[model samples]
Target: MGVFRFESKYAAPTKEQRERYMRGECEEHMFGNDGEIVLVLYDEAAYLKDDLEGVRILFTGASDKRKVDDEVRRLLEEHGQKEQRPDEFESGKRR
Candidate 1:
């Protein structure tokens, strides 16, 4: 089995609040990295809400780690989501 990844959820953007996001008025969201993985979580509630509702799921994995990348890619495939390029912004990949 591959090494399990740890959780590092920071309410870093908590101050930004969720109102701006739902209204599409957020000047900017926040991003973070789990190793080489990059993630932009506008609102934790919204993110988890979308994921739980099957609307969308933003998966992040270490770009340079084979096991992590493969695992994340597999999840995307299982969820019927197209794997997004690391540095490129695809239509459904980002908000």
Candidate 2:
């Protein structure tokens, strides 16, 4: 299994959205239009872990790193959030 991480400034997901995501009903966007930095994992079980700082999602099946990364990027884009570059963190510009 592989794990991919992404950062966002969006709000945390609502109860309903979280429920849907846990059931593997959210294909286009994990937390609908919410959630901050997200961690995507390829695993056998689908799971969602949400908190104040970020969210973590375990996909239902294993997938290539590229595919997982692309899906995360797409989800971020859909929510109008951009992944921060490493330099941003180094410069202390991350939010």
Candidate 3:
């Protein structure tokens, strides 16, 4: 019932990294530098069978938590996903 946040200067994870992630060998995969990537996880551990598919991408580009938070709000308004309260988590809420 906790949220995990991973920020990196990469665009997306690699195929091997994704496989490792699915195998629970790592918290997340960090590969590529096309832009920034912010991965948000709602589970306690990185053991999802979806292999990062279940994760959420807040945005792409470098920014502090504050700016990211604002972007997340904007994304919610623009393309609504599952219902969640912004105040539920310090960084972001679980879907």
lDDT to native, each model = 0.32, 0.43, 0.34
Give Cα distance to truth, residue 60, candidate 1, Å.
15
Task: Estimate the lDDT of model 3.
Answer: 0.34
Maximum-lDDT candidate: 2
Cα-based TM-score, every candidate:
0.22, 0.27, 0.23
- The model with the greatest TM-score is 2
TM-score of 1: 0.22
Clash count (model 3, backbone only): 0
Candidate 1 or 2, higher TM-score?
2
**Model 1 lDDT per residue over 1-95, tens place:** 11223233332223333343333422223222212223233322223211311232222223322333354445445444433435355577655
What's the best-to-worst order under TM-score?
2, 3, 1
For model 1, the run of ten residues with the poorest summed lDDT: 44-53
Q: Model 1 residue 4 lDDT?
A: 23
Question: Which digits, one per residue and each the tens of the lDDT, describe model 2 over residues 1-95?
Answer: 43323233344434654454345433332444455434533224333344433544444344533355655566556445433333334655668
The residue pairs that clash in candidate 1, if any, are: none
